[model samples]
Target: MDASASPAAAAPDPASTPGPGPVPPPAPVSRLRRLAVPVGAMAAAVAAFGYVAAVDPNEPGHYPVCPMLRFTGLLCPGCGGLRSAHAFAHGDLATALGSNALAVVGYVVLAVVWLLWTVRASRGRPLRIGVAPVYWWGIGAVLLVFSVVRNLPFGSALAP
Candidate 1:
């Protein structure tokens, strides 16, 4: 401590210290912008289903045969999916279910999933599908059973 060293002389100037000034608030996001992903997904689905409805899958040569059904004479889980979609698009629920019950169930599941996605997106939140392993196994089991049943003699009604 020197005799001439005063407390004010040792202090640094506050103006020289770097500090962050007032930060501007974040720009507000619009509702439509928040729902962009969901809207795009819905548009894509509508376009695909619209095309499937326009072109008849029941008519041979309109659409390619399922590779699994072509190679093996067995009905896969997605054997009559296009026919199901065609019937569904035409508002014929019975025919859609008859064409492919599993595909009809899938359509319902997809709709529910899409609704969930849209709702979350509208609320500015991301949709997170965190299915447990058990659920995945259950889905696999359903597909396996559907494929097997549609191919068996007792499951003639399930066949397309």
Candidate 2:
């Protein structure tokens, strides 16, 4: 060492030097931040369902009439969905099915999907949903058939 060199003037430690590998940058958000959107959406949906449950649509004037049915005097597939939800909320399965069988099925599907969504969100995984075009067309076809059937005299029992 030089006579004038002090302890602070020594060669830099190899451990303190930059390494050969590229450094990974810090994440823009923590794990909790990534979960916020999904959690919020789930909460909103639950609140909406709670509101629908609390406001029973079975009472004739509680909810607005379905415009399509009012104008056409024909039952659309969704004609009695609100009532169905009301029935479902009250634990009246028969009334729910009577009001709207499709709505009951939709409720079940929504519940299942929501459960999966919550699980995926908690696990910090991206949600994935892919409804093929054919499936969408099939849904449309089913709705069309339901509308037609509900309006026919033979299917009067299915009418809302």
Best by TM-score: 1
lDDT of 2 by residue, 1-160 (tens): 6844877657777778888866789766666877788778778877877888998776777788888878988888998888888788779899889999999999899878877876787676777999999999999999999989988999887876
Best by lDDT: 1
Q: Write the per-residue lDDT of candidate 1 for residues 34-122, one digit (tens) a residue.
A: 88888898899899899999999999999999888899999999988999999999999999999999899988989999999989888
lDDT for position 76 in model 2: 86
Model 2, CA-based lDDT = 0.83
The residue pairs that clash in candidate 1, if any, are none
Return the TM-score for candidate 2, rounded to 2 decimals.
Answer: 0.76
